[model samples]
Target: MAVLTVPITLVQAAKQGDKVAFMSLLEPSLEPGYRLACGMLHDSQAAEDAVQEAAFKAWRKLGQLREGHALRPWFLGIVANECRTVRRSRWWSVLKWPKSEHPVETSPDSGLSGIELRRALRRLDLNKRMVLVLHWYLDLPLDEISAITGISVHAVEGRLQRGMSELRRLMETRDEN
Candidate 1:
């Protein structure tokens, strides 16, 4: 999906506490933010909650946003942080159920590979996984990912390479078993 460009006037209005303008500026980012959360958390419900909480936090912290900065990456960064918070909660482990060993029968068009890919993604460490999600799943460029991750472009590139290598190893290992 194409990212929408927010008008500078709208951003100014939002900074000045215009709720409508804020919502307008925020609307386009919600889907991508949710997808980013889902990619990180691997649970749709948790992802939704993370995105919602991030949206609230973004509004509350809007004043901290610097001028000329892009909102999409900023919002996604908030979503990513929220996902991490949710994962770190004490209830996170308690809420997770072990997956069955045997794969369920899926229809021909069900894209079972996608399911397996997500399972493998869940096995990755958060840093590598976040880079993989932001780059591959969200189609974000390295610079934007660097901004969101608070890392250098070189670091982002390294993570992407390592993440892809690890992901490939995991996928190959899965195929062998």
Candidate 2:
């Protein structure tokens, strides 16, 4: 596979213990990682924690990143794994995940749409949700999404179709109320 736009020089420098290079290399992925975690975990703090953990792990394993690999999807795969870990931890049941402190900026007419969309998205199963979020929200292609989720491209397409259907059904159900 072709390498993502992240410069090979940056990757090489990062591997040689260059903190600045590592930070620069990792910067592009931060928001996408946070967004993915937020959609998965539904709590800003947990999402932040997950992203932090993923970044740390990525830094530690910087040497393992293969040449010609797309860094964004690969790093997101790590973030997804971190989210799964957070979900499975013993204390997860006891912990109360907090709501997002930052208010979403939406036009008056469209504000309700944002809320409805989020609710509909929350209704999806993790597998379906990840596929949907990775594809639509992050603007990743089906093949890139498959790489991040460790699923086949066909499975990703199926999940995307199902997820969109479910989201539409959910939004329509809300409209009936």
Candidate 3:
């Protein structure tokens, strides 16, 4: 399902001490947030933890959100930062890596294809992978992605292009196997 952009009214209401409203604002961003966290962290449990922490931080910092601003980008920024924190934890590396979560119902070829795609994605540097996932998977607009990533639109564009080029090359090489 496509994640709808959070309504500006919800953003305003959430800023005014409305907990329900605050959660309402976050509702639309939840699925996208989870997907982002999963893509970044590569672990369902870690993704959930990251999203939960980010949601808590988003609520606490709701007041800091400016009136009429796009909540999705700002909120996504928090989620991205939370994922970074999770990845940086010393224990994160010492622990066993997450097991592959193959799709239960997919055809064998498609399932293997997905694994290959994910592996290719993981090979990209975080900065490039981040832009590719946000733009392709999350379907976020360029300006919103730029804002969330704290980079210029031009830079976002550059990263998206370079990331896609690299990802394509990796996939082609894998297909030769």
Candidate 4:
């Protein structure tokens, strides 16, 4: 449900060494940027870093942004790229010890009280996680998610459906337990 209305003139101004314009251009995206980073990284610190890095990248590439195109997806593409970079740097070690090897067990009084949902979400492959986060948390449409992640629209839709189904199953199992 993000409706970006910032004008191309603002972006053009930002591209022409206008710091305030750039800030204005970047402002609306800050919240979703953090959310996307946090959901994908699942670590507050890493998420912050990812958002920071994404902001820098966006600044660097602001000129490449097309007129009339919304900025959110462009910004998200940067965040997703940062997440991939950070994740790849640790790919070897993480692959050696997959997080899914041991599922997260929830307990009563958990603040995240819906720990099963979080666990199941975390269990999904990175592509599925990205799709789910963009579609569910960010409320991005499948076309927008596909644009942000550079995947096919159908692929994004499939991942979202699969991720939701998996999450539901996990929640149901947790309730039964």
Ranking by TM-score: 1, 2, 3, 4
Q: What is the lDDT of residue 82 in candidate 1?
A: 98
TM-score of 3: 0.85
Best-fitting candidate, scored by lDDT = 1
Candidate 4 Cα misplacement greater than 4 A, ranges: 91-113, 170-177
Reference-based TM-score of each model = 0.88, 0.86, 0.85, 0.81
Give candidate 3's error at residue 14 in angstroms: 2.4
Question: Looking at candidate 3, what is the lDDT of residue 31?
Answer: 83
Compared with the true structure, the alpha-carbon lDDT of candidate 4 equals: 0.79
Backbone clash numbers for all candidates listed: 0, 0, 0, 0
Distance (Å) between predicted and true CA of 2, model 3? 12
Q: How close is candidate 1 to the true structure, as a TM-score?
A: 0.88
Residues 27-77 of candidate 1: C-alpha lDDT, one tens digit per residue: 988988987887888777788789999999999999877777788988999
Candidate 1 vs 2: which has more lDDT: 1
Residue 13, candidate 3: Cα error in Å is 3.8
Kindly provide the TM-score of model 4 when superposed on the true structure, using C-alpha atoms: 0.81
Colliding residue pairs in candidate 1: none
Per-residue lDDT tens digits for candidate 3, residues 50-145, read: 899999999999887776577788889999999888877999879996665642133457677888888998899888988988988788889888
Please say which candidate is ahead in lDDT: 2 or 4.
2
Lowest lDDT 10-mer window, candidate 1? Answer: 97-106
The TM-score of candidate 2 is 0.86
Please, what are the lDDT tens digits per residue for candidate 2 over residues 29-52?
Answer: 999898888888777788889999
